[model samples]
Target chain A: MTKTSVNLENPQGYPEVPPKTDSVSPIVSRVREVLRRHKFAYLSVGTYIASMVVFGLIVFAKGSNPFSVFAVVVQSTMFNGGSIEQIVLRTVPISLAALAVAVPARAGLVNVGGEGQLIMGAIGAAGVGLAVGASVPGPLTWVLMALAGGIAGAVWAGIPVLMRTATGASEAVTTLLMNFVANDIMLYLIYQPWRDRFSSGQPQSQPLSQSAQLPSLFGSQLNLGVVVALALVIATWYLLKRSHWGFALKVVGGNQEAARRAGLPISRLLISSMLVGGALAGLGGMLNFAGLEIQLVPGITATFGYIAFLASWLGRHDPYKVLIAASLFSAIALSSNGIQLNFGLNGSIVDILLALIVIAPLFLSKNRKALTK
Target chain B: MNGIEQTLIGGIAGGTAIVIPALGELTSELSGIVNLGTEGCMLAGALGAYAVTVATGSAEIGIAGGAVAGAIFGLLHAYLTVYRKADQLTSGLVIWFLALGVTGVLGTGYVNDAITPLPIVSVPGLSQVPWLGPILFRQDLLVYVGYFLVALIIFVLHRSRIGLLLRATGERPEVVSVAGIHPNVIQVVAVTVGALLAGIGGAQLSVGYVGTWFDDMTSGYGFVAVAVVLFASWRPLRVMVGAYVFGVALSAESVLQTNGIAINQYLLDALPYLVTLIALVVVSRRGGRKAPEALSRALTDVT
Candidate 1:
């Protein structure tokens, strides 16, 4: 493909030159073309920088030196040992959540139900653990919990997929509303039948047995969830970029009519993609539950699903890129504690930064397009 | 006087909280732009209104401030979604995040303070009636404002030339452009106006209802408002009914609690959202024939 394309003149209306006195080398011209194609990337980076300056001004308005806040943020999030581990732990759920969105996004479907799916997954895993933690072997119990979590997530996501396919309802709104429902269901369970009997006061589920908990990594605060998340990321990257099913799903996403014409099972592909995305999110929930919480409680996901949605968009729905974006966002989120402690600022200040990061590119790219025109 | 009567009155008041935003969303949807950021706008409006009302000791000024704050965010939304051609849902979500953060930061001071709430106006003659009087005649000023706004919206939507243009733009922008009106301008105006109303709704929630400031206080009213528009099938009068129904569902928790019913508070809290999801499915299954053509295309057509 490259060899065939290399000999073809740039179709963007660049002037043809005589071969005799060509001033630009072919390699340089190719490099320039690549750069031009990625102009939006450059603009997005510029916007990120501009947003940071605006955030600094906001800090100033709060009566603190922006530099000091930044120093504290960076020192705590990046330079510290415990904070780095915290970011890694946080990244596990966030990256998986991003993948949950990214996988379905490749098929031109927006699966915003990651939050619901994650919660359901956690509930599913917890249910399994509670039912057989004492009777089943440790490794078998863990395996069953993971499978239940994945299946639960898939089924949770499957509801919206079916709604979209059968009735043409907007999955975006339905998935979002389902998040609240999932939260309520989780709350009901913890507050009632699943409530830890021995523990008084706060409403929480009984703790998972030792067999149900995930093993930590290298004696660090980080758990094996990171390994699971990274493995899923690599597998997703392969499936999206190389697999035949991935190609078919992309075709379906690109044009349903064309895919139908090509004899692809459109509904099957759509449902499968959504299910895979949901399962990934569910697994993230299971990982979070098994690795960190060890008990079902409210706020277990901590809005990781929403943050992951932002990360997916920032990464342009690429699995590898989403991994990087999710890590960056998780770091910033982990550092918000320091910002709150040092500057007396609300921890939600990180949300403002995240919002700006998402929006700046839109405005900048628009300006660039107008300028180019 | 009784549980049923009290619940009915509370329902009307709670329903009004959603009505303003739902109305705003209807207008926005009619113009082919869906601003999910209505939630964010409402949050900002609530904080802005509460802060100003606390400062000046005037609820009216606070309401106006809320509208202004909402309009500002609406302008940002319009600029991004309209001019920049960003994804409407994503842009709306980002706007919401921004509002949540900004309000959370600025509203900390006002959390402990309270402002004088808008007084309920009772018509001397009409309010004397037993069953309907307290529920309808005796209410806050915003309820009356909502009534007038609904009537105005219905008339304008059905009878006016601008309304024709708005509907046409949502159905087919190319045709509207061919007819010499810029669709983008109409969209911007529609979204901003919608946000302004949503802000007012937020103001109503804080000043007229809660009479205090809080961070992220709009909850999911903005999203529920969006659902209400869909449930109403984008009609003005139906939006009123939908809002009232949701209000009844929302107020049920307190009413039941007051009556000593043994129900989980969290389940009650989840009722409105559950209803919304069910309503969406039911409505869609019945065929969403009333949805704008262009808006549907905007949601489904990727590329």
Candidate 2:
């Protein structure tokens, strides 16, 4: 049997005292407590430093100058104009994907299906846009695709939420399982049903018509999805921090039994949180497709959803902070290209850096129910 | 061989890989630590086995290397969850990422390298048996070990005092602690042993089954093993059955492709996970109260 109740032990991410160490500067520790609002920033910076050190050792072991390679990574990722645009473009999907995780997390649910949700969103968007054809106006196509993607994402996410509500299945496991299924679903479509007529060998869906594409911004590499992502971030902040629904969800998350006794509609809050999360992820997938990728391609999601999962945890499930975490992760993920071309390392080595950063904060966090329920 | 023959022949060996890990997972889950990073352990083991086998000419030693490699990942997970009290699912997922990256970087040079696979040996007397002989007796040393391990785990987990201690830890650690036995020690040991076997499973895939090392090559087998443990309801025998079921799903994908059938390979690739999802739902709906009492209460608890 799985968890009888939603196992939400730690809502405040890493709310533990820093492990006492000579390296933990007194000033930093004081700042973490004084500027509680900026604690995530400090946590990120700390994680970044720790990851760099570990990454340096790895590079050194590989017979490379860690300092020089890191210099290249930072310079290429932050200073180069084209690189900056790519990072921003990457952030569009990542931020929305992180929001996909963050929203559900606010209700004490872990929505690890962001990757699957995003893929479904892309498939939904592509299917709708292709069917709408070039006859439809550009703005109309966008709305229709967004709706299709959002609904597809919501439905995908809803399946797991339903399973969790009905049977105490852990959302974490079910959602992760759904991701692979979603990818296969996409592969099946592109392989036969949605196979592009013009493309050969590499199976892909038909490219969206020119009118269906999201417009690029100011002749740069980025698209108008940036604005959409930003607006959603602000909206999430308001909803999570200010709204009645948000309060109800929090009540449910904080104490399910208490919320139920209070007649706050516990199951409704859980389902609504997950639905919003899934819809955002779907929107992310659609935006990524229409904005950057011209057509459905293999590995298109490219671990964007996974990184966004880490980003949400990094942000402690707050919308504004998630935006920052997404941006940081976007930079790190984009730096993979630089590392790949220079160090001749596999592109996936970046996951080590990201994983290190994410896990570092766990050492300090105190889960009140860590050893007890 | 006919298509059905090929699936059975292929599935038994493939099933060895999953069942090994599933058995290991059963041990840890019984001790109350649900290590989702079993996938990471398998990946690490696959690479470790391959690299060691390449460096040394012994597949036997490679299997040991694989066990050690997997155990390290398991140990890390144990530390994070058991001592650090980090969230188990998150920690498990992060461990997978860490293993994926580490293996990807380390296995880069071995991508094109190859090793001589473990030769299959059939039991002389058993080989002549009507049907069960070929499917059960004809396999590599690792497959034989898997068979032995299953019987060993089932017997030890049920009949031994240690098994009772382990099961007791999962049920209520506080009560176990009251009996003067530290539950954390037992949990650490159980999780490590589970990972050790999972690593051997990876070695079985690389050295005994596939004979090649590739990045993320275990695919979803590691995860499937985790799901198998869940649906198997922590029963060792049922876990083995579940593993074989997924094993056939994997084999059918290849068998259909080889038979010139036009079914979508990707769709076939998804069947195991879909089945796993459905199994979790269906089993849970049936009052799935077979988990350790403590574990079922706090899903993320490692204590």
Candidate 3:
């Protein structure tokens, strides 16, 4: 009995390993494990709450009802019918942009040029829609405009890809730099002689014909673009999960060396990834112009490409998840009006909050063991 | 006196905005990380300084506040990219978006009113010196600091022991770690310094060049800085030359416009951007012949 005393430590000066115990249900345990593993997830969600509370407190300090303000945020975004429509309308481009990014992200590529590409695409679509407002039939005109926009976006993105492949340039720099080029080009269009003749001195483009506009989904401002967005999501989900080309894309993403070894066309995949991504963004531009404003404005995109990047990241490039993330972002943008009315906060704060929510996950995962490896 | 001089002057002023962010980015890249958030940091610095200037009426305080704001953004970027190992591109883009959105909101109050800009301080005989005088000496104090910073950066990057360590870390962190130094610590410092410079640069734009701050005032100067870094080939002297060259191109549009010349103002405004793009193509086309060996991995990988 004395010799049978339990050993607290092994001879190696480490604690004795315990024997396996009863396992929790796989499904339930997995859910708990994921939540536990990703502390950043909780932290990010908490950041959303904390930012609101802090903003509310500041509002109160400035002489307002913090509670009522908070209530309004929830009510406008979540419960109101008109507000919900506005949110959905905002989600259209963002979701498309997310898909644009996610399509390439699956191949382990970063597409920082979404902002530029989206704008270029919008400009392209607007150009076609504006130029051919009454010449072509409505449906044919819409298709042509969408295709033109997508092609322009692809071409814009193609320059960086070609450079990266041909000269070993960093796409990050090139893509970013291209953004300015695209912006300047757009500015030149809006400000120079190409400026809409109707606006005496202002810098804006002519509005598209009423027939060029995408029909509303119902009585709301939401248009056929939402349907297109949903369709793309479903198509993407299927392609990624079930198609061979998607498999090839995943392989390319997993490891370039391995993909090369397996005789996969790495260069083709790289260029195509960027092309498709750009095309999607361009399609988003068409939707935006056709469904929402029916015109091109200087700040029309309003950084939707970036918000899409966040959505893609939050969704981890999964189509279903992208849908959810896009919807959430749209809600945030919609609630911005409420936030402004009640708290005197500008709508841009919505972007700030969205960004914080998007990136805050990093802080909470600082000590993760897997990250160390 | 002519279009050339006007373009040259305008370019010099606008180019100042690109310098700090480029320097900061150069610092980060040299220390083994690429900050995508330079755009955001620049915006934060610009807006922060503007907010401070309006509230405090001190350009120095505004610049300082801008630096602080930039440093905070840098720290956040470092913690995410370095510590948590979050996707560098992801964190950077997020930061950029956050800055754009947040700063846009905070910047609304100052949109209508104009703040007093920094007065020019000439350096005596240097200010009177012919072509060089107007080009180099007839600007605010920040302009002089820009040149001094370039020289200092060159000196520090080449002559100091820490510089060697930093360069080595940028090339290969594993090698640096084997030598028993903390790569993360060095990277954090590099990022912070880079961000600080960027903030100062941004402040110069709103306070030194222009008399007031407006939303989106940066107009992608931060992005131009990235191109500048590439154009410079990671060398300080070359960066100075490149920055000035970009500056000249920017000023060209204004000079042309002011002269009553029949030119497309938009096309002129687009020149710097187009030139930068062409420069990038030309530089990149030079291939492995000119690129820093360490950058090979970064160029191919998305992150």
TM-score of chain B of each: 0.97, 0.96, 0.94
Count of clashes in candidate 3: 4
Off by over 4 Å in 3: A1-66, A192-195, A199-203, A365-373, B112-114, B177-180, B288-303
Q: How are the candidates ranked when ordered by DockQ, highest leading?
A: 3, 1, 2
Error of 3 at A13 (Å): 22
Tell me the tens digit of each residue's lDDT in model 3 across B1-303: 656766666667767777767888888878767777888888889888888888888887888888998888888888887888766677777777778876776677778757767778888999788886887788886787787888888888999988888888788777788768888888889988998888888888888887677777777777777778877778777667777788888777666677778977766767787788778778767652354334445444543
Instruction: Give the DockQ (2 decimals) of all models.
Output: 0.65, 0.49, 0.65
By DockQ thresholds, what CAPRI class is model 2? acceptable
Structural similarity to truth (TM-score) of each candidate: 0.92, 0.91, 0.89
Native contacts recovered, in order, as a fraction for each?
0.59, 0.62, 0.78
Per-candidate Cα lDDT values, in order, are 0.87, 0.86, 0.78
The candidate maximizing DockQ is: 3
Model 2 Cα lDDT, one tens digit per residue, B208-286 = 8899998898987888898888887888888888888788778888999988898889999998888889988988788
Report model 3's TM-score to 2 decimal places. 0.89
User: Residue by residue across A1-373, what tens digits does model 2's lDDT show?
Assistant: 7855543765455576766686768899787667676655566577668877998899889887888778878988999778988998899889998999888877788888999999999999999998997988999999999999989999889999999898978787788899999999999888878889997788799999999999888987878778888898899898899999988878777777889899988788899999999999999999998888968888899989988988887787889989999999899888888889888988777888888887786654443333234
Per-model i-RMS: 1.6, 2.8, 2.4
Model 1 TM-score, all chains together: 0.92
